[model samples]
Target chain A: MITTIIIYTLLAGCLIASWVMSREKTIKASKMALKVLVKTMPSLLAVLGLVGLTLGILSPQTISSLIGTEAGPLGTIIAAVLGAITLIPSLVAFPLAGSLLRAGASVMTISAFVTTLVMVGVVTAPMEIAYLGRRFTLLRNLLSFAAAFLIALLMGVIL
Target chain B: MKTIKRYLPIIIIGLAFIALAIWDPEKADASLTVSRDYLKEMILIIPPVFLLMGLLEVWIPKDKIRSWLGAGSGVKGALISVLLGTLPTGPLYIAFPMAASLLGKGAKVSNMILFLGAWAALKIPQLVVEMKFLGPEFTAVRFTLTLIVLVIIGQIMERAFTGRHEVLWEQPGESVGQKTKQMGTKR
Candidate 1:
């Protein structure tokens, strides 16, 4: 909700500014936007499809069951892997993490899940690479993945 | 063959959908529903985001961007990068183009790295959700640790990628040489 409002507000502001400055530039910008959209369409569509398939097959119940039953260190690893690959919205993911925590999932496991869920983007890598280049995407994601584990470990100790 | 190579991922996804439909219709329907929801969200967000990017690309001069967020901007530049990043926005994928834009305009790799990291992990709304679900203790600890990690990661990546910026798929309207020059590519 806030995201929508902020984005639309920024877009409207920029569009109006561009229009007032020069109609030609505004038009060119619009065309550039369209070209980028088209260029990235394949990867976008691919990511959407993959996210749907993953979420559809691995229902929340299934995820909880898998995470809830496993032991600590191994469970945290699985959670991290699942979080890295999956693209659950934070709204949905947080409550799920809370529940998992209450249901005996370790702080470490839930932290790993939440951290990687936000930081890493195995599913969105194609779109990321398309926009930011392969090496940038690879380094960012790999480093974030490593950082997520460190965060999880520290969180496990502290809280 | 070129077209095939380009769309191969989409094609594979299509085949996967077909396979799911044949093997388990209910699962396929569920997947389609999720995809529909995602598509709707993307449709609402992507156009405006891209347009805003377009405007940024056109209206914001490279020098202006460099002065504000570039290599010499230092600590203040990094703060601005985080501020720009933490705006309530769409997914992490949306940040990639913006980050690329910043890069093309001479933003420090470290600042851009910070931008991407903050955008991914430290948005205000996301933090609230984290606090709500995980408690202040967990949230605060992770937030602090993540910030430290991001700064360290940023510095390392900046040093590693110091002069190697030649990559395919040029931004619209900029010549390859111009881009190479702006990014300080050795070649």
Candidate 2:
């Protein structure tokens, strides 16, 4: 809701200002936007479907069951993999993590879930590759996956 | 045929959805519901995003962009990138095109990493929600650790990519990325 408002408000502001400045350029910008919209459509649709499938199969309930079902290193690894693969909206994910915490998920496991859940995105890689390309996506994600574990491990040790 | 190849992913997903609907209608319904909601998001957000990027391309001067986010911009650029990332409330995928645009416009690769990392992990609104669910202490510790690690990752990535030459920022397309990959192998 807030994102919608912020983005549209910015868009309206930019559009009006640009119109006042140069109608031709604003039209040109709109054309550019349309071209990009067309270009980005296929991958965007692909990602949407992929996200649905991933979340559908690995629903939050299923995820909680898989993760934190055990505790210790095994649990952490399970949580990490689930987190890396799944693309839960943060709104859904945080509440789920909190409940898992209450329901016997260890600090280590929950932190790992949250960290990798945010940092590493296996599902969205195709859309990312569409814009940023394959190698950059692979490198960034691999590095982030490693960083998430380190961050999770430290968080586990500390709090 | 090319169109079929291009739409193969969607075609495969359509099949999967159909299979799920036949096997378990409820799961298929849930999946579609998720996709529908995100479709709403895509419809609402992507237009403004495209318009904004176009305007940004037209309105912002190249030199100004360079000075603000270029190789020599240093800590200021990184800070700006993080700030840019945190202010927006959206999925991580939304950051990809914006990051690509900035990279094409002379932004440092390391800084784009920071922008993306912050957008993904350190979003302010996300943190607030995280604190409500997780504890403040947990959020704080993870925030600090993630930020620090992202900067380190950014530094390492920039060095790894930029080591070869000015291959990355000179061109602004995925083909260049493939070239970088090929170059990395030759080295």
Model 1 Cα lDDT, one tens digit per residue, A1-159: 677898898788888878998999999888888888898898999889988999888778778888899967899999988888888888899889999998889989998988888989988998888887788889988898888888899888888
Please provide, for model 2 over B13-53, each residue's C-alpha lDDT reduced to its tens digit, 9 standing for 90 to 100. 89999999999889999999999998998898888887898
List the lowest-lDDT window of 10 residues for candidate 1 chain B.
B164-173
In candidate 1, stretches whose alpha carbon ends up further than 4 angstroms from where it belongs are: B166-173, B185-187
* Candidate 2 interface RMSD after superposing interface residues: 2.5
TM-score for chain A in each prediction? 0.93, 0.94
- Give the top-scoring candidate (TM-score): 1
Candidate 2 docking band: medium
Per-model tally of clashing residue pairs: 0, 0
Instruction: Give lDDT per model, in order.
Output: 0.85, 0.84
TM-score of chain B of 1: 0.90
